[model samples]
Target: MELIYMKKFLDACHQAKRITELMPKLPERMTPRHIHVIDALFQLEQKEDSVKVSDVSGFLGVTRPSITKLLNELESLGAVEKIPDEADRRVTLIRLTEKGKKYYNFYVEEYQGWLLKQLGEADTEEFMTTVNTIARVYKIVSDQKTAPVFPGEE
Candidate 1:
């Protein structure tokens, strides 16, 4: 039973990966990873006054090094600006640049449109119910596991 469940989960993850791979071809300047970091920045927009590199790392459940790499990429792309904290010069605060905001909004709209088009052909009620069910199951399983139970595992 566990094996069967694992197989299905793997299949689902493969399908999701395929979709993510296609996102880069959707007339966007940023890669999917860049978009993910931008989305995290958007979520932290309300706390603009206190947004820090560590804060973003914690919020995104990623390591500081990983966030640093993403930040470096974003900085190179002129999508984010890193400023030294006034009180503590060692700490860096990150904020989205105007270009970042523009691209983020564009990607958000494009992604939304793509999702809407994909789901429009399905029965809305059933599709939403399935999505909710899957989300709940995923949350429960993810919270109970120490490691990811899906892809990237051998």
Candidate 2:
């Protein structure tokens, strides 16, 4: 039973990946990872007065340097800007530019329209509930006990 379940899960993941590949291409110099960062920034913006690189890094469970590198690319693309915090000049905060907001809106509108068209209102709601259940399972598996890293192992 578990083997069958695992196979189905793996197949679903592959299908999801293929579907993403089929989605419309992003603008030049931008990729799916950039969109993920943009989405993270958008969500964090709603909850916090100011969003920091570390906050994004934590939210995405990625390294700060990775977030910084993506931010630099987005900055070059005029989608985001890094500004010094007013209260503390040493700390930097990130904010989406007008372009970023536009892109976020576009992506949301496109995805919602596509999903609704594909599944209809009732089925779309059910599909989302299933997806949310899978996400919870993933989080549980990721949080499973693991051996602690030694001081030098990393």
Candidate 3:
């Protein structure tokens, strides 16, 4: 009985591993750092000014120097522009150009669209239930790692 559920869990893990394998490597001259920065800018959308280096650094838990280097690479690609912040001349803000925005959208949305396509045939609630069940079992195993054993279980 437990083996049946174990098989199901292993199957799901294998499928997720395949999904990771399917994701492409970054393009020439670009690293995951650049993508992380782009994603940070998208999320840090401030009305008054463009996103700043500090913002990306904070979001990614990386140092400003490293993020600045990645930003330099992105700037050379003409994907992003560094503008002087309106409120603070000392601070530089990062803003994605149209090309950068398109690139960011492509990277973020393509996988999401592919996933929706894969799940499209399933009924939504049933899909959610199955996903939730997998999540529940993962928690059970995670808890067991820290749980104290009963007297006979050593």
Query: In order, how many clashes per candidate?
Result: 0, 0, 0
- Per residue, candidate 1 scores C-alpha lDDT tens digits across 24-52 of 46333457888888889888977677688
RMSD for each of the candidates: 5.0, 4.4, 6.5
| Clashing residue pairs found in predicted model 1 | none
Residue-level lDDT of model 3, residues 1-154, one tens digit each, is 7899889878988997676555567667876557667767777774434577887888776789988998999999878899987788999988888978877777767765777787778798887887898778778777777778999988
lDDT digits (tens) for residues 44-152 of candidate 2: 9999999999999999998999999999999999999999998999899999999999878776567756866886557667778879977887787787476476799
Error of 1 at 150 (Å): 18
Give candidate 1's TM-score: 0.73
lDDT of 1: 0.80
lDDT of each: 0.80, 0.86, 0.78
Better of 1 and 3 by lDDT: 1
Residue 24's lDDT within candidate 1 is 40
Pairs with steric clashes in candidate 3? none
Error of 1 at 124 (Å): 8.9
Which runs in model 2 stand beyond 4 Å of their true positions? 122-129, 140-154
Q: Say which prediction, candidate 1 or candidate 2, comes out ahead on lDDT.
A: 2
